[model samples]
Target: MSLSRNILLWMSENRWMKERIPKFGFVKKAVKKFMPGETEAAALDAAYQFSLAGIPSVFTKLGENITQISEAYAVRDHYLRLIDKVANRKLDIEISLKLTQLGFDLSEEETFKNFTAIVSKAKEKLGNTVFIDMESSAYTQRTIDFYKRVKKEHDNAGICLQAYLLRTDQDILDLVEFNPAIRIVKGAYKEPGDIVFKRKILVDDNFFLCARDLMKNRSNKNVRAVFATHDEKLIKRIREETERNGIQKSKYEFQMLYGIKTSLQKQIAKEGYRFRVLIAYGESWYPWYMRRLAERPANIWFVLKNLF
Candidate 1:
């Protein structure tokens, strides 16, 4: 890792700093990098801006790890409301959700019910797509199983996979059989080296390999893939693979977070490829916001610049 990235990782993982910084104005400023503002209006404003730029979006509310069924259902309700609002505006946007935020820890059945409600809402409101984000290894199997079942009930729902994990190759194979949309990401959570490949180069290599496999083997034409990264070389590799496999440009899209690498995103769009930006909203963003900074250390420079 670069020295800057190492510092970011340290800031993100340091429990002491996490507890202290949010008390200061750091949380507010850090949030502006990832979130437009803390309301649905702020999120919708972002969606409008991206749409106006000819880019599309997938909105997510950034909070997870729910222990209560009621809290999960509340999250479900918020997403359901988001569906209605986005659809009413006829915006070119979709949504992603974390399963744990939907009460996965409470019970499998309850989590499914929450998911069902959210998916149903998405279907009802202008048929926007929904993606369920994959979490840590402890919940990986359950998340995959839930995606399978949810896809059976809803046509527009999907899931995310982390390229860092060892079992992801097989996971992709199994999931493609369901023909659900997928977003492949280099995972953000810190994990033990055993279950996950610890080296950045290996993780990135795995991501490229998976992107190729998806482009080559996905059965449904509309079963799309989102290559979510800021790495230019990785993007180039996927671009080559997509062309080599003769996958139509519209069959897949490039994805990046909202505030990182705006120029790169625009350039990719200008080059005639579809780009979708992930816009995160909500007040519970300390963990998620920190991870975003860790992914690219330049974000820390931005933070520091504003501090003075």
Candidate 2:
């Protein structure tokens, strides 16, 4: 990662900044560029608007790693209601969430219960897959295992995998039998060079390679591979490869964040590729917001502009 990105990722993990940064007025203003609002209603409304533009969306409320089991339960209930709202609104939206947000640290059993319940609800109501949002390196193994367990019971279960991890290629191979809906993203965390690619070009190369690997399994009707990034070069490479190999668009999709590269998102959709926007909202926006800037430090300009 670049020095600016590394610093932003470190800031994302700092407890003092996590507590205080979102309290800044300009920071809050800047975050609006990425998130619709901190409310479920705002998320639903944003999804509705995106749907009109021929772009579907994945919805996630942004808090994670909760301390209390009750807090986890409340989150579960919130998602259940959000599912109901999505159904009522008649929108083309799916859900993504972190396992830690559902009490994974406190109790795996409760986490399993809450997650599977939400999955079952989505299966029934939306007929859609619920995604497991991947976190930092520490949770990687447990998350893969979690996805395996969820996949065994639910066909509508999906997962996010990080391309920057050196082991992701292996993880992708291990998951082939499950025929997973894998959303591959260029990782944003501050992991060690021993475990992850320290250079951006290597990560980009690995992302395209892994995406090509996923696309090769395109004939599998159940496989739903989502390449999640805004890297134009990687996107071009994937597009060329897809066309060269005659891969159908349904075999995979492109995903980007809500505010970044809106024009590219529309152009991709117009080109008849499957595309989805990740729409994140919630009160716990500090760490997530920091990572957004880390992903592309240029976004710091937006925050700086807000300051004036």
Candidate 3:
């Protein structure tokens, strides 16, 4: 990563920075360029608009590492109502969330219960899919374990995997038995060199390798894959590999963050490939926005231009 990106990512996890940064008007203005708004209503409206444009959306209300059971239940309830909202509006949308946000930090059992409640409700009430977003490397094993246990009961659920992690290759192979639905991402966390690829090229290479594995395994019919990236070269490689393998475009999708690459998203959707945008909204957006900047350091220029 570039020096500026490294700084921004470090700041992203700084407790003091995260608590104080979003209080500035300039910061909030920059955030609006990424998220529609910090309310469920705004997020739902954005998804509706995307549906009209022939693109599906995935919504995640941002906040994580809850310390209280009540707080975790509140998060679950919010998603439960979100599922109902999607069902009532008949919107083509899925939901994504962090396990920690559901109470993993407080109690693994409580987190599992909360996660099951939300996903079960989504599956039973609306036939909607739920994606478990991967966090930092510390929680990787536990997250996968929880996902495996959950997958045994609900086939509609999926988990996100970070390509930047050194263990992701083995992780994918291990998950082959489940024929998992995975969203592959070039991880954004500021991780140690020991456990993650420190160079962008290595990360890109691993991403393509993982993509190839997923595409080649599509014959299983249960390996639903989503490539969550904005890198054109990597996207092209995955597209070519999928075509070379004769994998149907319907079996996997390309996902982009909302507002980051509107034109590219439209182009992908226009080509008849499955395309979805992750639309994140909520008051707890500072860390997420900083991570977005770390994902593409050049975007800081865009924010600066808009701000000044």
Candidate 4:
């Protein structure tokens, strides 16, 4: 990564920055360019608009690593209500969330309980997939293990995997048996060079490899794969591979973040490719916002523009 990106990613992990940066008015203004607002209502309204254009959305309330078990239960109940909200609105929306937000740190058993309840409600109400958002390297194995356990009971469950990690190639292979619903993205965490691909080209290459592996299993009806990225070159490469493999356009999906590439997302959908946009909301956005800037240092200009 470039030095600017490296610094921004470092800032994303710094507790001091996390505590103070969100206090800046200009920073908050810049954050609005990514997230519509900190409330789920704002997120849902934006998604409802997208649905009018025939675009489906994934909703996630951002906050992770909660300190209390009661807080986790509240988070769980929040999603249960969110699912009901979607069903009531008849919107093309699904739910994605961090396991840590549901108390992965407090108790794995309780976390599983919380996750299953949310997934069960989604299954009963919307009949859609409930995605488990992957976190840092520290929780990688445990998250994968938890996802495996969840799959035993819920088929409408999916997991995100980071292509930047060296182990992801094998990780994808191991889950092939589950005919897993995997959303592969170039990771956003500031991980060490030993475990992750530090260079952009290497990460991009790994992402393509992961995409190809998932698309290769298109013949399986249960293999629901999503490529969650904004890299146009990599997206084209995946498209070419998909065509060459004779995989139908509906066999896999492409997901991008809200407000990042609106035109490209529309183009992807217009061209008959399945697409979804992830819209995140909630108070715990400082770290998430920093990581968004870290992904593309060029976005610093947007932050700077907010100074006026």
RMSD of candidates 1 onward, in order: 2.2, 1.1, 1.2, 1.1
Question: What's the number of clashes in each of the models?
Answer: 0, 0, 0, 0
What is the lDDT of every predicted structure here?
0.83, 0.91, 0.89, 0.92
lDDT of 1 by residue, 135-206 (tens): 878889988888888888788888899999988888888888777788899887666669987789999999
Give the alpha carbon lDDT tens digit for every residue of 136-234 in model 4.
Answer: 999999999999999999998999999999999899888878868999999988888899987789999999998898777646647898999999999
TM-score of each: 0.92, 0.98, 0.97, 0.98
Q: Between candidates 2 and 4, name the one with more favorable lDDT.
A: 4
- Descending-lDDT candidate ranking: 4, 2, 3, 1
lDDT (tens digit, per residue) of candidate 3 on 1-308: 68888999999989999889888787788888889999999998999899998998999999977778899899999998888888889988899999989989889998888888888988887786899999999899999999999999988889999999999988988887886889999997888889988888999999999888777766765788899999999999988888887777887899999998799999999999999999999999988899988877887887777668
- Candidate 1 deviant stretches above 4 angstroms: 1-19, 219-222
Residue pairs that clash (backbone atoms under 3 angstroms), model 1: none
- Evaluated against the true structure, the overall lDDT of model 2 is 0.91
Better of 1 and 3 by TM-score: 3
RMSD of 4: 1.1
